[model samples]
Target chain A: MDIPTYADVEAAHARIALHIHRTPILTSSFINDLTGAELFFKCENFQKAGAFKARGASNAVFGLDEKMAKVGVATHSSGNHALSLSYAAGKRGIPVTVVMPRTAPEPKKAAVRGYGGHIVECEPSTSSREAVFAEVVAETGAEFVHPYNDPRVIAGQGTCSKEMVEDLGELDAVVAPIGGGGMVSGCCLTLSTIAPKTKIYAAEPKNADDAYRSFKAGRIIADDAPQTVADGLKVPLKELTWHFVSKHVEDIFTATEEEIVAAMRLIWERMKIVMEPSSAVPLAAILKNKELFAGKRVGVIVTGGNVDLGKLPWAQS
Target chain B: MDIPTYADVEAAHARIALHIHRTPILTSSFINDLTGAELFFKCENFQKAGAFKARGASNAVFGLDEKMAKVGVATHSSGNHALSLSYAAGKRGIPVTVVMPRTAPEPKKAAVRGYGGHIVECEPSTSSREAVFAEVVAETGAEFVHPYNDPRVIAGQGTCSKEMVEDLGELDAVVAPIGGGGMVSGCCLTLSTIAPKTKIYAAEPKNADDAYRSFKAGRIIADDAPQTVADGLKVPLKELTWHFVSKHVEDIFTATEEEIVAAMRLIWERMKIVMEPSSAVPLAAILKNKELFAGKRVGVIVTGGNVDLGKLPWAQS
Candidate 1:
């Protein structure tokens, strides 16, 4: 697969203009005072499916040919990606099937159903999910929309940066959490093209630092049974995402679980926004490496807000 | 005091421009779809001190005469108002004394100290609080900064609507939660002057429906030992606020405790904002009276976001 160009990002922005939310850019004096960085947060938590996954899902659904569109779309996600694909497909009057782990949050499951997606519950394991999704594709003949491992998805996610840059002007650096690396890869690709002088960084939770390890080793790395509050960052990296990130990203930093919790609390208390632990990774990275970001104009992508209020990691017993 | 005219709001906007946050207007397709109203959420939760009280506090502090400035300012509040006064006074290098109930949240007391305000804890009863504040002012010679009852504070709070009207042209109606009535009274005054056709409505919790009762009876009504998740809306209606609200407000509506909790959840889940129960009053009203707001352009002032995550009302035990 070819690397997505800046033109592809521009085209994606135009195509998904009406479909996705032009999420707000939030700046905080409290955050700036704490980190000494002029930070601009792209609030993708306010995106259509409560995450940046909507951008990718919308693009993939709209990119399909008439025959492929008739086949509809399928994906395996126990979190935001499932709901995003379901929402995007449903909006386009297309059928969607989502394979999710049975252990997924009840609210997330309800959201997928609310968006009219057919849910296939699989065992709570990566291998089980992939196997069930394969069977689903075979039975339904649906076009598979890879969550973060496809060029179309990456290009689509890049539109977020394109809009942010348009709205907030050039930034000295851009930071986003690296899960399967779709958002960071897209951010890197877009920033490298539009603002080449800007540094691009990927933040990952220490419990699920496969992307960080991979970036350093110049090869794919996987973490099995990762343990972190940022549940969405547990997925292993794919070659397509790894390749794009390696080419465009400048560095990958890891944030400890405690730091992630602190950042989540700060966003809740100071910014007054409900950010999932995955979304807090970027802020965690900034807070952890304050010296690196101090006095710099930085852009951070808040990737999603799909947290269960009841299960918030910070609530003291 | 004269009712705050559009000119007064414009003047307050200028005076407090450097002191408060120009909070962003938040829009969400998910929330719009759920409510069937084209809604614009003015995120005062992102304002300084985690609420719009900052605007009033800052205005009151800075609006004082040089002689009065040297005397400093004092107020009685459970949380947000104390923090706002502390923050505003700290900026002006003026000493501030906060009279807070002994039963106030620990986090709120910490915030007052964190912002460098001197605290004087009193009994939780309203009479006790008033007596304690009066003693503090008499002993320290600090000018009283009544939360939501003073003209300067009302003028400052009016700036919120001024900014909203400038950004989102010609709103059909503006909704605010009424506690002491500072926010709604200010909003009503400004909307009446600039956008006279725009209706101003106050949302009150059913458990503490003093404002609704007062609006109907054409006299001030007080809630004794008010019980609701909306701690900020428990304060009784003041004479000045009651007068302005009676003349300018189109109506006052009440929402149940369950509806407030549901609205708070919807804001967290759909809009990705951590709104306190008081802030959710407008949302609860909108959700409960959909036919009244259907297809109308409505603006809801999300008053504050200061709920303790550990003790959130909706958190599962």
Candidate 2:
């Protein structure tokens, strides 16, 4: 497979512009005071299908050749990507099947179905996920759109950073949560080409620190069943995403579950925006490692807002 | 005392240009489909002090001459106005004293203090509120800024509609939640002038339906201690606000507590914005009275967002 380039990202943006929202950027004086860094939040939480994954999903679904599109599309995702692809398929009036772990948030499952996507359940393990997804593809003859590893999806995700830089001019740095490193890799591809002076930082939950481990060790590491409140970020990285992460990322910073929840709550209370725990990881990392970001103008990708309102991370169990 | 006019609203907007945020407008296709109306939400929750009250408060504080500014400003309120006045006063480096109900949310109280305002607790009664406020103004020699009844404050609040109409062209009608009727009166004051054909609707909690009763009976009826999850709507309409509510408002609608909570949750879940229960009242009313708004372009003022996230109205007791 060929590694996706900035040109691919530009093509993805042009193809998906009509389908995706040019989501707004929000800033907070309170958050700026907390870390002494001027931070701009790219509110992808308001994105169609409630995530930045909609960018990649739309790119994959819309970019399909006439013959391949006739077969429809399928993917195995913990949550966001599943619903995003479902949204794109629903828009195009094509069939989509998502293999999801049964433990995925009920909200995401309901949203996927709301967008007319079928769900195939799997155990929260890579073996079960791959097996179930393959079974669905074989049964339906669906064109498989890999959640993160595919060059097309990487190119699609890169469009987020492209919009961010174009809207914000140049930022001193950019931070985004790293789950399978799809968003980070996209940021890397765009920032390296367009804003070459900008530093890219990847934030991860300490409980699911596979990306941090991979960056520090210079090799890919997989976690079988990492547990954290940030359910969307428990998956391991793939070859396509790791390509950009290893080459262009400045560093990977990790925040504990407590820090993640606190940062999420702060944004909810102070900035008055609803976002999932995964989206808060970048702010959590910045707050924890203040020296690295202090006095700098940074961009934080607010990844998504699809979470059960009843199951907020800080709610007393 | 004289009523505030469009000229005053325009002047207030100029005076407050430096002290307040020209808050953004948001819309949800899901909500529009559900209600069969094109809903434009003016998000005053993202206002400088997390409420539309900031406009009035900023105008009042900033409009004061240097001699009156030396003594600062004071108000008696439940929550949003208290914090809003504090926020405006803080910006001017002036003293602000607030006579607030002891039962007000802790988050609002914390914000008031954070903005360098002194809070004096009053009982949840009009008599106590007036008495406590009088004592504070006398003791501190502060200029009294009525939460809603003042012409300056009404003109300031009217600016919200001026901005909304400027950005949205002409809506078929405008809906705003009625607490003490500041925001609704502002809407009436502006829509009646610039967009004369656009009707105005006021929403109230059924539990605190003084505004509805006032509209029905053709006279203002005071509520002693109405109870509702939307704490901000507990106050009764005053003479100045009653003028607009009686003459210009098309109708007043009351919503049940359950409906208000549902609408609040729907916006938070779908629109991905944090807004107070009071803000949801207008949408709740719209959902109930669909015939009045169906197939029309409607504007709903999202009042404020300064709620304790720990105590969301939808959360279990």
Q: DockQ: which candidate is best? A: 2
User: Per-residue lDDT for B11 in model 2?
Assistant: 97
Candidate 2's DockQ is 0.89
Task: Report the lDDT tens digits of candidate 2 across residue range A1-317.
Answer: 68988999999999999999999999999999999999999999999989999999999999998888888999999999999999999998899999999989999999999999999999998888998888898899999988889888889999999998999999999999999988998999899999999999999999999999998999999989899999889989888888899999999999999999999999999999999999999999999889989999999999999989987877783
Question: Can you tell me which runs of candidate 1 are displaced by over 4 Å?
Answer: B1-3
Error of model 1, residue A165, in angstroms: 2.6
Docking category of candidate 1? medium
Error of 1 at A206 (Å): 1.6
Flag clash pairs in model 2.
Answer: none
Worst 10 residues of 2 chain B by lDDT: B308-317
Per-model TM values vs. the true structure:
0.96, 0.99
The candidate that achieves the highest TM-score relative to the unseen native structure: 2
- Model 1 earns a TM-score of 0.96
Question: Please, what are the lDDT tens digits per residue for candidate 1 over residues B1-317?
Answer: 55566677788888889999998888777778878999999999888888999998998898888899988999998788999999999999899999998877777888889999999999876788998988998899999888988888898999999889999988988889999999988888788888888999899999999899988998998866687889898898787788789999988999999999988888888788987889999989998888888899999999888888778887764
Off by over 4 Å in 2: none
Assess candidate 1 and give its lDDT.
0.88
